[model samples]
Target: MSDSNTSDFTNPSSFILQGIPGLEEAHVWISIPFCTMYVIALLGNFTILFIVKREPSLHEPMYYFLCMLASTDLILSTSILPKTLSIFWFNYREIDFSACLTQMFFIHCFIAIESGIFTAMALDRYVAICYPLRHSTILTDPVVAKIGLAVVLRSGVLALPTPFLARRWPYCRTNIISHTHCEHIAVVKLACADTRLSSYYGLSVVFLVTGVDVFFITMSYAQILRAVFSLPTKEARIKTFGTCGSHLGAILAFYIPYLFSFLTHRFGHNVPLRFHILLGSVYLLVPPTLNPVIYGVRTRQIRDRLLRLLTQKGT
Candidate 1:
């Protein structure tokens, strides 16, 4: 919601040399809102981490992925907020090449991991719901460990090429990134050379990661649906579906906006920049804040634990 203001043309700061995107006026309305959300995201994630660490009962696969998601969400929040807030408050919009890449790497890395973790979470839910009898055997420590490792490694490897490939480009002119954060496509737009390869590579990575991930997610949910249908009573069916309500809510919130942002960028870049920015911002901002409330506060157990912990500290 903020733009760098100190882009001095006379001596374009080291960061300004790469051609700055026009820093549109800052959204004073959102600067503090996002900042507050940043704090909430951090605290929420840390609470999940603490709960998982302290409660041995929660050390299962489902909570494990939830902890991982919390961590990734915290990292995601931190990666973007500093720059965005800086631009909003200090108008110090300049970002060095190294800083930009650093920002880009963390943002995408966390995002990739988030995507992978969500898929893993979907599988966990699937195993728990569809194969309840064998859930423990199906998702053991070693198996979950391997899944975690694979998720991290896959995301890291896939995101590796983005920065590596983008760095090779000779950025001749425009560098001002329109959005609050340095997203991959937006940053790549600054490159002066042929972006066809880079764009293709980026899309290929998305398809390879998100496409496969979403397919698996769908499959897992399908199994869940079938399994739920086999249940006898109305209450049983409702209970089975209840377990996934928060997760489904989170998935919809995360994916719908992401697709919209991607499509708006691909086909409607000419549309009002604010529209794109708004959609993009909602995706980034809402998920983190809403996730804890949706997934944690809505759950009786987690809510009780959180409230009990808060009450303990109130003294």
Candidate 2:
């Protein structure tokens, strides 16, 4: 190993994050839009959470799941964007090794939890549409609490290994991460040691959480489609589809960019670097920014409450 890499293992102090390599000159400009997105994400999700909390009528399973989603989005965005903006705006790029691992852990853990929540939402929708009469009994408050707890614990436990494994790897190279955040692969690639097992583990985690969530969500939607088409009237079908619109939008927003980014990372070696970086940024930013908008526009309850709250504040 080179002397610098050897020293990295012996006395690693900090890792420098490269935000967007060629756009260092434009970081000030970049921060404007990124900061805007972060603000929108925060306000939008917290509004959703507030609406859920204040509205007693929205104490159903579907809205409860929505609350979980909003909370997850808020935490996820908060975890990354502040540090990201610090890097972009102030060139605050160095992160302590242990702190980097902790950030990476929360990032992956929340993502996994969000994916699990998506699956739970799917199941909730399936029961609501397929077995309407039993929906209340099936997804009672206690049950929702249990599901929420399980989702949190599952992701927390599963993602624990990521930072631990990365921490153990001897980073025998320049401690420069190629992205804004300390992503598992981004940090692990800095290590000179063989990362095959860790890399595979990362892939496995992705497939395990996202893959399973997508599979179940698809199944739920398929069953929903079948049930919708079986409705007695076209109006009934339209109404049913309308109710699912917000969720479908949220799912597409979350998964499409995510899957695209994942593909580009593994297979898009020839693709432009800007595309890879921007896609990852979009994956992180878009869902949080758009989820509340989709929910607000499509769900009458949230929209009405939000408008009332704004009106009250204005008055």
Whole-model lDDT, model 2: 0.87
Q: Rate residue 34 of model 2 by lDDT.
A: 87
User: Cα miss at 252, model 2 (Å)?
Assistant: 0.2
- Model 1 — which ten-residue stretch has the worst lDDT? 11-20
Report the number of the highest-lDDT candidate. 2
- Per-candidate count of clashing residue pairs (backbone under 3 Å): 4, 0
lDDT by residue (tens digit), candidate 1, 159-193: 88887777777664555666777677777776666
TM per candidate comes to: 0.90, 0.95
What does candidate 2's lDDT look like per residue over 195-314, in tens digits?
A: 898899989999989988899999999999999999999999999878888888999999998998999999999987766776777688888899998999999989998889899999
Q: What lDDT does each candidate get?
A: 0.77, 0.87
Could you list the CA RMSD of all candidates, in the order they appear?
Answer: 3.8, 2.2
